[model samples]
Target: MFFSQLINLKEDDSSMQFIIITHDAEIFDDSSVENIYKFESAPDGTIVSRL
Candidate 1:
């Protein structure tokens, strides 16, 4: 509910920008969000990639 509210607020306010860190793929189920950065574990360290 709260997550949906945040999206609604962003839509209502054009200047609003949000950076959400979530493991839920549902966040990407909508087109309201643009740009995605994924992080995963690696043997040496962490790997960051743009998805």
Candidate 2:
């Protein structure tokens, strides 16, 4: 999953942070992130998913 926010440069002096939760540890393999979460899943290919 991905999370992002828009901030006004004229109002905020610091950058925004986001939180993400995922069942796979490999999701961050070739990506950079601010945070991460991991969990196990069933092998049937469909065990509850979200966009």
Candidate 3:
């Protein structure tokens, strides 16, 4: 519900920027998202990648 509202808000106001950290992949399913970063724990250390 919150995500849906956020998406609508973004559409209404183009200037709004949101940085969201979520475990649910459904958030990334939105077509509005152009860039996605994934953080994962590796044996050596934490790794960040663009998806």
Candidate 4:
């Protein structure tokens, strides 16, 4: 299962851009996502979080 969110950013010149946040590891590691950032979380309990 995966979760995702989209965010909008506005610039001083009134230009708008979009940002995407997701839990997909493959998408994060893909070369096409060179300009994107990735974050990882630690296990909170007995379950280990992947990607």
The local distance difference test score of each candidate is: 0.75, 0.53, 0.75, 0.46
Candidate 2: clashing pairs of residues: none
Q: Is candidate 1 or candidate 3 better by TM-score?
A: 3
Cα lDDT for residue 44, candidate 1: 100
lDDT order, best first, reads 3, 1, 2, 4
Residue 41 displacement (Å), model 2: 15
Query: Which one is best on TM-score?
Result: 3
* lDDT for model 1: 0.75
Model 4 clash pairs?
A: none
Per residue, candidate 3 scores C-alpha lDDT tens digits across 1-42 of: 675686775645566666778898686685577778888999
| Candidate 1 off by > 4 Å | 1-14
lDDT of 4 by residue, 1-51 (tens): 122222133224563344666666566563344355545555763434333
Q: Give per-candidate clash totals.
A: 0, 0, 0, 0
- Evaluation by TM-score, superior candidate among 2 and 3: 3
Q: Residue 35 lDDT in model 4? A: 59
TM-score of 2: 0.34
TM-score of 3: 0.55
Per-residue lDDT tens digits for candidate 2, residues 1-51, read 333324443365876765555456686776666555444467865454332
Q: Distance (Å) between predicted and true CA of 43, model 4?
A: 13
